[model samples]
Structures are given as structure tokens and as C-alpha cells.
Target: MLNIQNTKLFWASCLALLVTSLSFGIRAGIMNQLGIDFQLSTSQLGTITAAAFWGFPLAIVVGGFVVDMIGMKRLLVMAFIFHLAGIVLTIFAQGYWSLFLSTLLIGIANGTVEAACNPLVAALYPENKTTRLNHFHLWFPGGIVIGTLLVTLFVQLGLGWKVQVAMMIIPTLIYGYLFSKLDFPVTERVSSGYSSSDMYKAVLSPLFIFMFICMFGTAITELFTGQWIGLLLKNVTDNAILLLTLTTGIMVIGRGFAEPVVHRLAPQGVLLLSAIFAAAGLYMLSTFTGNSIFFAAIIFGIGVCYFWPTMIGFVAENVPKSGALGLNLMGGAGMFAVSIYTMFMGNFYDNLIVKHLPAGASLSVYLKAPENSASAQALANAKNLAGPEILQATLIIPIILIVAFGGLVIYLRSRKKSRSVAL
Candidate 1:
């Protein structure tokens, strides 16, 4: 029988995760507006956006270390405060720095949600860690779908970006209220009698370290692409935000029905296959244009649907001794990698525009031109030419994941065989 209290806590965690993903979707939708309104370069925009990723790692790592001592409720309270503050600050942001700091705060809240809730769900359903984790994480994409649709609708209605951003406070408050009223269980690591030293030692194990490194590739493959979908694919489609909606919509379905897939393929097998599809999908996106990008988006969505949760679940199940710290560490590393990559991608994208432009032509000059002028058209042509190249460059990350995950599959199988033979 299900414990009602545990189920409620689980759903509350889902709601909290929804707020995190809403921030992502809303931010992706508003990237261009922020750039234009601030008269900022792509690199500056990227830096502001990347602040969230940077702050994510810091909060999750610290929350992980202290969660056991400080308790999940307190951490969630901190998340609530940060979320409310960040959203309000973002709504009233005047310049790049304000936006950066506000986004950083939201990122911290996002990380804290994962820190408390990953272990919360794991502890709630100790018997079904991977499937439940996948179910819980389904809300990430699920919330993105909600957020993106809101942005689409708001855009249609001529609503400002700030209004879309303000909408996040609704779910944020709901989740905050739910968490405050409920009681949290002890983490699985604590209940299972593992010491802090055991967790520390386990996280440093060879296998854990290997997976930790692999998280970087998987995360960038999924997140960097999703977050920048609007900008990267803008020239390809009239409404690029819809592509984010489409991809995340597919993810919601994939993750919602993750159990049978998880059972059939195992996490390692699923990851290996995901890497293959993600690489192929990215390649197709670079090569294809117009409506064909939809097909490619479908492929890309399926490829990344299971990545974040499965990665966390694998650690939780296989490296149980590593506990919350290990889980948060994996998540933190992924976000940190994304932060660095976002900055690089912004500069690389700017350079690519220069490469495609006429000799000695300045992009800034084009930017300052009238909307209907020849310079504006030149800028458009340059962006169209440069956009696909960004996707092509990202293709390498998933290609690397294919090999890494393939090796992991073989290694795990061999170990399973060795243990069975010995037994």
C-alpha cells in the first residue's frame, strides 16, 4: 500500500521541480527580447544566461553537503525565498547585471530543489528509485511544456516577457505552501545506516568518478541545446520557441512512461541508445532546414528525454553509499559544464557570424541600422548562415557520449557476468 504522506511529498517535489523548469522555458523564450532591449551582444546575453548555470552548481554542492544535517525542509525554505526574490528581481531588472544576479538566484533555487528532492524521492520509494526518479523528473520537461505554451500564448496576446516571468510565482507559491505543511522522511542514506565517511568514500570511487565526468557530456547535450533552441533555430523556423515546446512535449511523454523502457534496456543501455539518437538528431538538425527540423527535433527530444533522471538514478541505485552528495555532485557538475559551454558558445556564435559576413563588415554596424535597411538584411543572412554551424559544433559532445556510454555498457555487463559466475 502507498503511504499517503509519502505520495504527497513526492508530488510536492514534482511541483517544486516544475518551477525550476518553468524558469528555463521562460528564459529561453525571452532571450532575444533581453538582448534587444539591453542592446547587448550575444556574448553578453550568454553571460547573463550562464549565471543560472554557474549558480546551480554552487547551491547544489553546498546543499548536498549540509542536507543531512540541516534537513530537507529547511533547504526547501531557502529555495522558496530565493525563488520569490529572483523572480521579483528579474521582473524589475534594469540592466545586464541585475538580470545576471536575479538569474543566478533562480539557479540557486533550482539546484536546491534537486538537492532536497532527488534524495527525498529516493527515500520515499526506496524500492523503485530509477522509475520514480524518472517520474519525478518528468515534471522538468512537463513544466517546460507548460511554460513554453504560456509564452506562446502570451506572445500571441501581445503580453510582455515580464508577465510571463511573473506567472512562475503561482506554482512557486503552491509548492512552497505544500512543502511547509508536510513532514519529510529521513534520506535513504541515513535510514540505510551509511555514515558520512561512507558517502564521501563512495563518491570518490572509480565508477562514481567516471560517471561524474560523463555527466558533463550528457548535460550539455541535453540542456545547452534545449536552452538555446530559440536562438539557434530561429532562422530555420518562423516560431522557434515552438521547437522547444515540441521537444519538451515529447520528453514529457517519454519520461512519463519510462518504467517499461527502463526495465527492458537498463539505465546504461538506455543512455547508450540516447547518445546515439542525440548525435544523429543533432547532425540532422544541422543539415536540415524548414519543416524537416521538426523531424530532427523529435529525434533529439527522444534522445535526451531520459538523460538527467537516469543519470541520477544510476548513481542512486549503483552507488547508494555516495548518498545525496553524489547525486547533487553529478547534477552540479553537469550545470557547471553547461555554464562554461554557454559562454564559449556565445563567443563562437559571434565569431561564426563574422566568418560568414562580407569582408571587414562589422556586426555592430548592421545592428544599428534601420529595421528595413540593407545592413539588417545582411545581419539576417549572417545569422542564418551561422546558426546551423553552432548545432554542428555541439554534435561532438553527444558523439563522445556514444563512445563513453558504450564502454560503460560493456563494463557493467562484464562485471555482472563475473559476479554471477563467482556466486
Candidate 2:
């Protein structure tokens, strides 16, 4: 029984998530720096980005099974340790291989945060699970807002990017201190006598299976697009930080207002509308730029804003039998999309650049790009064409989601009507 008002615990969890979101913000800001420092191609940076996702599924899938037994505190402790170590490692990273390993560790820490906190919040406010999840997730974009501002601040101060990354350590330490002694309720899964085998059966059920599939598209649409925003806008804008901040600011407000939205649209209705927004937004982004860019971003941000939380909320409400494992599986499936697509998109962007190069131009010559000259202009041209092409390719994901979510809404509405008629 969560009889006590553990407001501290809730805030501690949010702080931890803020660290995760801040890490994402910092990374988005520094991606171009990393590319220049390492002299990496778009695809190679994709591999580095992909590294951050490698451990996500590993931790999340397993964390679901163990979170009940080991407790959220211990998992959070693990996250803190990895978070600290990963930051230190990232600060010291020199090349692709080093960055890859460090990001992989940080990815594990990020996954651990989700694995621990999702169930913690769900357990904390069982009466308002979905609403609280939406509220809790507000920090993801909020942290981005903070991070974007911080990035802008740090750049204005003429500080190195390392200082920006090191700044995350302050919150990381604060959250660790906050969670050091707070008591946690064992998940509903354990309290209700649900077994691991039962969890397996629940998650494997047809309804959950459909959700697992939807998670891939939804995660790809939101995260893949969000993470790559700076890179995708390389040619369109000299500074994308404002655009990134504005888009996420819209998301934070959207999530903040989720309670009313949920009452009005229900989760499925919101998702259906969100899919339409994401599809249209990405499609427009693929083809538009300059004056039209901000409008497209608003459309897409609104589409993706509700996706992660609503999907988590849907499963928690509708698939109670699967318990924390259900949330874990869904979360893991989403990360899995990042792991695969980051690499694929990287390679896709790289090939686009290569294919766009002048006829009879040696690929090796561009690979060893000349710092300043016609060679530089030619390379810029390749990237300009490649960036938008990559966005165009991602449209297929939301297009598929539209049909899937559309079917689910119809089926759920029918189910609701049947129950009402019976009553």
C-alpha cells in the first residue's frame, strides 16, 4: 500500500529522468562537434549513435524480470554508477571505437532509468497510472528545454562541449543522493503473486503482440526523428538548437495537458491522431525547408509528443496481467528500433552522399575530404541532398502505423459498444 505521500520519491525519479533527457540534449548539440573532431562520415556517427542503444534491450528486457525481485532502488543505483562512469568515459573518448563503448554504457544506464522508474511511478499512483506516466514523462522534453538552453548558454560563454557534458554530473549526483534512502513498494507483479511464466504468457498474448509491433514504428517515428533532428537540419539551418528546443517545448506542454486530452480522446484516439500528425509531419519535413520548416516541426512534434507515454499508458491499463514485464518489453522493443535504425539510417545517409558525388569522382578522394576548397563545397552538396532523403525514407514507418492504429481504434470502439449493450 502506497499509503504515505512519497513526494520525494516521485521527484527523485523525475530528476533521474532529467539526467537521461539532459544527456540526450547534450548529445544532440555536440553531434556535429563529434563529427568534426573525429572527421567521421554521417554513417560512422550513426554507428556511434547506435552504440547508445546496444545495451538498452539487454538491460530493459532483463530488468523487467528482475526489478520485482531486486527492487527499483538497486537498479537505480546501477544506473547511477553507469551514468557516472559513462560520462567520464565519454569525456575521454578520442575516436569511434571509444565513443561507441562509452555510449553503449550510457545507453545501459538510460535503459536502467526507464526500467526502474516506469514501474515505480505506475506503482506509486496506481489510481492515475496513465495520467501520472504522462506527467512523469514531461521532464523528458523539459530536460531537453533545459539542456537546449544550457547548450546555448555554454556556447555563448565560449566553453568547450566537455563542460556541457560535465554539467550533467551535478543532477546525476543529486538524484543519487535523493534516492539513497527512500523506500520503494514492490511492484504489483510481485504483490499480486504473478509468476515469471505468467508474465511470459501475458506478453505473448495476441493483444500485447500487436502493441509490441506498434512500439517499433512509434519509437522509430519519435526517437529516431528527434535524435537526428540536428543532423537532418544541417544544411537548412546553421543553428538547430532553437528548433530542437521549440519542438520539445511543445511536447512538454502537450504532455502536461494530457489528463484533459486523455479524458477527451482516450489513449487510442490520441494515438490515431498522433499517427496522422507524425506521418504528415515527416512527409512534409522530407520535402520542405526554410520558412516551411518550423510549421512542419510543429505538426510532427505534436504527433510524436504523445506517443511514448500513451503507448506505455495503454499497456498498463489494458494489459494488467503482463505487469512490469509488459512495460519492460514495450520499452525494450522501442529501444530495439533505435539500435537497428540508427545504424541503417547512418548507412543509408552515407550511401546517399556517396551516390550524389560528382560523376567520375573517386569515393576515396571525398573520404579523405579536403578541408577548404571545391572539394568542401562538393561534400556539402552531398550532405544537403542526403539529409532530406533520409527523412523521406522514415515516412514509411508512420504510414504503416496509421493503418495499424486505425484498426485498433475501430476494434476497441466495437468492444466498448458491445459491453455497453450487454450492460
Which residue pairs clash in candidate 1? Answer: none
Candidate 2 residue 423 Cα shift, in angstroms, is 3.6
lDDT of model 2 at position 353: 81
Off by over 4 Å in 2: 1-5, 362-364, 367-371
- TM-score, each model? 0.99, 0.96
lDDT by residue for model 1 (1-423), tens: 349999899999999999999999999998988888877888888898899999899999999999999999999999999999999999999999999999999999999999999999999988889999999999999888888899889989999999999999999999999999998888888999999999999999999999999999999999999999899878778978998899999899999999999999999999999999999999988889879999999999999999999999999989999998999999999999999999999999988888888899887777667888888788878888888899999999999999999999999999999999999
Candidate 1 structure, TM-score to reference: 0.99
- In candidate 1, clashing pairs total 0
